[model samples]
Target chain A: MAELVFLKLGGSLITDKRRQETARREVITRSAQEIAAALAATPGLRLLVGHGSGSFGHFAAHRYHVRQGNLEDWRGYAETAAAAQRLNRLVTDALLAAGVPAISVQPSASAEAHDGVLQTMAVTPIRTLLDRGVVPLIYGDVALDDVRGCTIISTEQIMALLVAALRPRRIIMAGEVEGVYTADPQRTPTAERIPAIGPHNYAQVEALLTTAFGVDVTGGMLDKVRTLYGLVTQHRGLSARIISGRPPGAIERALRDPSAPLGTLISGDGAAASPAVGGR
Target chain B: MAELVFLKLGGSLITDKRRQETARREVITRSAQEIAAALAATPGLRLLVGHGSGSFGHFAAHRYHVRQGNLEDWRGYAETAAAAQRLNRLVTDALLAAGVPAISVQPSASAEAHDGVLQTMAVTPIRTLLDRGVVPLIYGDVALDDVRGCTIISTEQIMALLVAALRPRRIIMAGEVEGVYTADPQRTPTAERIPAIGPHNYAQVEALLTTAFGVDVTGGMLDKVRTLYGLVTQHRGLSARIISGRPPGAIERALRDPSAPLGTLISGDGAAASPAVGGR
Candidate 1:
C-alpha cells in the first residue's frame, strides 16, 4: 500500500473570502492541477483533500449563529448546511474538472460533534474511496452536535480526526501565506517566516500568531496551529506543514517533500525549528 | 408537534429523463410551490422531501453499473456520487428559491447498506432539523454496503428506512404517472389505474406490475410498490399513496388528504382496491 497523505486547501485559497459565495475558480483549478501532478509523480500516493468553507459557508453560519448552536429556528440549521454544501460542490467540481477523481464526503451527514468536538466520524467510506485510488474531498460543515445541538466544524479539525484514523504519512495545509510568521506579514513588513514549530519553541510562536477575521465561524490561523500542535503531540511520527498555495508548485513541493524549506513544519521534535528565524 | 410526512419527488417528474443532466426547472418550481401551498393549508405539517437522481445521476450510474455493485474501478464510485450531488443541489436550490426551508441530507454520507439493505442510518441530525421545523431533503445515491463494496440506493428505499424510524403519518410518492397501473400504461392502452393495493390482492397486483426502464438504475415502479407494500404492512396505521405530480394539485391533494381520489393508496387493509380496474 502507498503512503497516505492528508491535504487541506484553505478556504481563502480556493474562494474569494471577501465575497460571499464566490469561488476563486482559477485558483482552485490551478491547485487541483498541482495536486494531480503531485499524485502522478509520487507512485502509490494516497490522498484525502479537505477545504475550509471560506466565504460560502461562513456568512450563512455566522448569520445563523450556527457555530454557537444558537439556531433560533430550524432554518438556521438548514441554511447553514446548504451553504456549506454549495462550497463543497464547487471544490469537488473544480477537482474533478482538473482530472482529479475527487468525491465529496459530507461531514454533517456521517459525523457528529459534541460541544464543538468531533465525537464520532465514519471514515470507512473514505477509506474505501482511498483504497480504490480515489480522493475523498471533505470541507468545513455544520454538524449535529450531541452537546450543543449543532456546531460548525473546521476542515483542520476534520483533518485531525482523519489523521488519527488513517494514520497518514503527513499533512499539508495549503493556505494563502508561505508559512507561519512572527507577525501578520501584511501588517508587519519585517515579520519573518518561521521554518518549524515543536514543543520547545511552540509556546513563543503561539503567542505571536493572530486569529483571522471576517465571516469565518471556525477559529482562524491560531486555531489551526493549536489543533495541529495537539495532533502532533499525540502522534509521534505525525507532522504537519503550513504553506502558501498561491505560488506555483508550493503545494506540490510540500506534498512531495515536507522537509524542503517551503513551509513551517509542526512536529514532535524541535530539531526542524530555526531559533534565529523568530523568538520573542 | 405536527404530524410528519414523507414526500418523494420522482426523478422523472423533475427532470427530463431522456436527456442526461437536464433538469425540468419549471416542473421543480411548480412542485415546490404546491408543497409550500400544502404546508400553508395544513397547519402543523412537518415534511421531509426526497428526490430521485434523474438525468444527473442515472446516466453515470448506468454506465458504471453502480446498482449491481459492479464497480470495475473506483472512478465509477466518485463520478456516480458527484453526479448525484449535482442533481441534489438543483433540487434543493429550487425548493429554497420557492421559499421552502429545504436542506440536503445525503444518504451516502449518513446511511450504510448491507447487500442493498439499509444496515444503519444516522437520522438524529434529520430529526433535529424536523423538530426545529426545517424540511430535510434527501435523494437517491450510492451508499457503502457491508456485503458489497458499494450499492445504489433509491429515494423510496431511504424513505422506507425513515418510515420505520420517524413513523411518518403517510408517504407520498409523486411520479410521472397517476399511480400503479394494471399494466404498462404506455404499452397497454386498455390498462386502468388501481385505486389501492393491500394484502388481499397485493400478490395479483405485484404480478401485474412492471419495472421501469431508461436511465434509472433502481428497479422502477415494481420496486417502489414492493418497498411501499412492505412498509404499509409493517406499520398498521401508516399508509402510502402513489400519485401523479404532473397535475397541478396532485401533490397538494395527496398531502392534504391521502384518500383523495387522485392516486392509488396502499394501506394495511384492502378497502379501496377495484378489481375491475386492470385484470384482462
Candidate 2:
C-alpha cells in the first residue's frame, strides 16, 4: 500500500444535527469533491472514509434508548441502523457522483460488542478494499452485543480500530469548527483555537476542552479529543489534525500537505509546536 | 404480532443470472407492487422480504472462490459485498417507490460463521421490524467466519435461521420455474412439477430433483429444496411454497391464501395432498 490515510467527515459537518434525518447535501458534495481531488493529486493515497450519522441516526437511538441495551427495544436498534444507512447512502451517492468508488461497509454487519465495548470488528473487507485501490466507506451504526443484545458504534470508534489494524500515516477529521478550542467556540467569544497539543501541554489543553454541543449519544468533543490523543500516544510516527471543513479548499489542502499547519495538531513525540509549553 | 410470513424473491426471477451485474428492474418493481397489494389487502400480514444476489454478486464470489476462504483474497470478499449491496440498493429503491417501508438488514454485518456454517445471526432486527409492521429486507452477503476468515451466507441460510428464531407460518419462494421439477425444467421437456412433497414421498422427490442452473456460489436448487424440507420437518405446521414469479398474481395469491395451491408445496404433515405418494 502507498501512504494510507483515514479521513472522517464529522456528523455535524455533513448533516444538520438539530433536525431529524436532514442532510446538508451541498456540504457533503463539496467534501466528496475535495476527497476526489485529494486522491487525484496523490494517486498513491490509500484512503478509508468514515462519517458520523448526525441527525440521520442519533434521534432513533436516543428515542429508543438503544445505547442502554433494552432487550425489548430491538425496534430501536433496527431503526437506528436504518437511520444511519439512510445517511450513508446519501454520502456514498454523493461520492459516486464526484467520481469516487465509495462502497459502504456497515459496521453493524461485521462488528460484535460485549456490554457496549467493541470486541470483534472484521477488518478484512476494509483492508481488501484499500488493497484494490477502492475507497471503503464506513460509518457509525448499530452492532450486535453479546451481553446487551445490541448497541451503537460511533465513527471514531471504527476509526480507532482501523488505526490499530492498519497504521495509517495520519488521520484528518473535518468538522464544522476549525479545531480544538480553549472553550466551546460557538458559545465562548474569547475561546482561542489551540494550535497544537502535545505531552508538554497535555494538562493545559485537557482542562480547556468542553463537551460537544447538540444531540450526540456518543460522548461528545471531549471524548473525541481523548480518543485522538490516545491513538497518537499508542502509535509512533502517527499524528492527527482536527480541521474545519467549512472553508473551501481546506480539506484538499490538508490532504495534499500533511503538515499544512491549518488546524490543531495532536502528537505523541511533542515534535509539533506547543505554544503553551514554555509557560508550563 | 399478526401472522408472520417470509417471502424470498429468487435471484433467477429478478435478475439476468447469466449476465454480470444485471438486475431485472421491471420484475422487482412488479414484485414490490404485488407485495404492497398483498399487505394492503391483509392488514394483519407481517412480511419479511429476502432476495438473492443473482448476477449482482455471485460472479465475484465465484471468480474469487470466496467460498474456499483464500486468506490472500480479501479484495474478492470486499468486491462481492459491494456487488451485493449495489443490487440491494436497486431492490430497495423499487420497494420504496411501491410504498413499502423496506429497510435492508445486512446478514454479513451480524452473521458469524464457523467453517462456512452460520453459527450466529442476530434476529432481533428482523423480529423488531416485523413488530413495528415494517418490512425488513435481507439478502445473501459476505459474513465474517471464525474458521474461514470470511465466507458468503446465502438467502436460504438466513431464512432458515429466521424461521428457527421467529417461527414464521410459511415461506414463499418466487423463482423462474413453477416449482420443484423431476428434471431441470429449462432443459427437460418431460420434466414434471411436484405438486406437493411430504414425508410420504420425500425420498422419491429427493431422488428426482435437479440442481439449479446459473452462477450461484451457494448450492443451487437441490440444496434449496432440502433446506425447505428440513425446515418444514423441524417446525411442524409450517409449510413452504416454491412458485414462479413470472405469473403476475402468483406471489400475491400465495400471500393472500396460504393454501392457494399455485405451486409445489412442502409440508411436514401429509395433509398438503401429495400426488406422487399414491403409487409409492
Candidate 3:
C-alpha cells in the first residue's frame, strides 16, 4: 500500500560467510521481531526485504570456485546462483514460519543474460508482488551468462538495479558491523567506524575498503559498495546505507533516520557532499 | 555393471495431471511392489529410471499456455518448469519410499539449452550415482532454452536423447494401458488389444485403430509406439513396450522378463514380438 523501504540483509552477518555457519538465526529471528515492531512503531510504511545467502551461499560459491577469477564459467555461475536460490527458499520458509509473507523471485528466472552483463531485466512481475504488499525477496545470483558464462550478480547489484528502476526514497543494507569502519574492527584495534560516507569521498572510502574485505567469500565488500556507488552516481538515484545488522533494531532506526547506528551510508551524491548525519 | 535399461514412467496413469492427485495409487503401489519383487526374482541387470512429470506437469505447461508457442518469456517457462520440478521431487520421494533408490536430477539443473534440439546430452555428473547402483532419475523439463525461447524437453525427448547417446540395452515405457490396443476399449464395444505391432506398420495400425484413443493425452498409443520404435531401431537396440502400468507386477515383469507381458514389443527387425514370447 505504502511506498517500501528496500532493505538489504547482508550475508556476512546472517550466515557467517567466513565460517560457513548459518548463524543469522538469532539475528534474523530478532530482526523479524524488530521488523514487526518497526511496522508497529512507525505508521503505514511497507517493507520489501532482500537477504544475501550468507555462508551457505558465499562459502559454497567460493569453494566451488564460482568466482575464482575474472573469467567465469556460465554453468557454474548458474549453479552457484541456484545454491543461492536454495538459500532464498530456506530463508523464505523461515520468514514464512515466523509469519512474514515472503516470496522468492530468483534473478535467473527474470534476467536475460547477454554475455556477462544484463541485456534485459523484467521487473514488471516483481512490481506487482511488491504492490500487493507481499515482501518480495531477492538475493545475489548466478545470472544468465552469454560469454564466460554465468556471472555472479551480487545482491548489491540487485539493490542498485531495483533502486535505479524504482527510484525508491532510500535503501538500507544490513550488515554485522556498525556502519562502514574506516578499518576492519576485528583486525585493527583502532579502526574508526565512519559515521557516514558521501559521493565525494566514495573513492576514498573504497580505497580504505578493497571490496567487502571481511567474511564474504562470494566476492569482496568492494564489489558491493562499488556496485552501489555505480548505481547512485550513474543513475543519480536514491540513497543507500551499509548498516550493522547485528544490533537489535538497527534497520528500524535506519529506516526512521537518515542516520542509523550501524554500517556506513552511501548517498547518491557519490559518498561526497553534505552527508546525512546519524541521529544516534 | 550390466548395461543400463532406461525406464520412463508416464504420468497419465498415476495421477490426474491438472490436480496432481495420486489417483493411480493402486496401480503405482502395486507396480512398485511388483517391480521390487521382480528385481529380487531377477538378477544381473542394472536400470536407470526416468519418471515423467505426469499430470503434475503437463497441466501447468499446457494450462499456462506455455506450449502454445515459443517466446522470449523464459519466466513463463520457468514457472512451467518449476511446476515440473515440483512433480519430479514428489515422484522421486514416492519412488524412494517404494524402495527404488532413485535420486531426482532436475533437468533444469543439468540440461543446457543450446540452439534447440539438445546439442549434447550430459549425464556426466550422475555417472557416479549410476555407478554406485543408485537409480539416476531424470524427468521432462522446461529447460533454459536458447532458441525457441523456453523449450519443453519432454520425457519422450529425454528418452530419445539418452537412448541415442547412452545406447542403452533396452528402453521400457510404462503407462496405464495393457499395451497398445486396437482402439479405446472404454469407448469402443469391440476394441481389441494388439498383443504386438510390426515396426513399420505401427503407425499405420494406429491410424486405423479405435482403442488408440481415450484420455490418451500424451498423443495416445500411436505416439508411444512411434517413440519406442524410433529409439530401439538403433544398436539394433533392445525391445521396448507400452504396457498397462496399473496392473500389479506389470512394470516388474516388463523390466525383468527375458520377455515381459502386457505390452506391444517393438523390435528393430520389424517382428511383432511379445515381451513374454521373446525377451530381447
DockQ values for all predictions?
A: 0.58, 0.22, 0.06
**Candidate 3, B152-225: lDDT as tens digits:** 67777777776765677767788767666566676677877666666656667756653445444426555667
What C-alpha RMSD does candidate 3 show over the true interface residues after superposing them? 9.9
Q: What is the interface RMSD of each candidate, in Å?
A: 1.6, 4.8, 9.9
Q: Residue A54: error of model 2 in Å?
A: 5.5
Model 1 residue runs over 4 Å out of place are: A210-219, A270-280, B210-219, B270-280
lDDT of 2 by residue, B40-130 (tens): 9999899999999999888989998888776675567767877888888788778777877676877775577789988777676567557
TM-score of candidate 1 against the unseen true structure: 0.92
Backbone collision tally, model 2: 3
Where model 3 places Cα greater than 4 Å from the true spot, the runs are A1-280, B18-44, B70-75, B110-117, B200-206, B209-218, B270-280
lDDT by candidate, in order shown: 0.80, 0.81, 0.61
- Error (Å) of candidate 1 at residue B239 is 0.8
Off by over 4 Å in 2: A1-6, A12-48, A54-83, A86-103, A108-136, A142-154, A157-171, A181-192, A198-240, A245-262, A266-280, B70-73, B146-149, B184-190, B210-219, B274-280
* Highest TM-score scorer: 1
Q: Put down candidate 3 lDDT per residue, A36-138, tens digits, no spaces.
A: 5666665656666788777766764675565432232323343354456556655655655555545455555445445556555556545644554556677
TM-score of chain A of each: 0.91, 0.93, 0.82
Candidates 2 and 3 compared: the better one by DockQ is 2
**By summed lDDT, which 10 consecutive residues of candidate 1 chain B come out lowest?**
B271-280
lDDT per residue for candidate 1 within B1-280, as digits (tens), equals: 5889999999999889999999888888889888888888887899999999888888988888777686566667778899889888988887877778887888887667889887777788788778777888999889877777778888888888888888897788898998888766777788788877888878887766643322243247777888888888898777788889999888887787655776788877554454422111
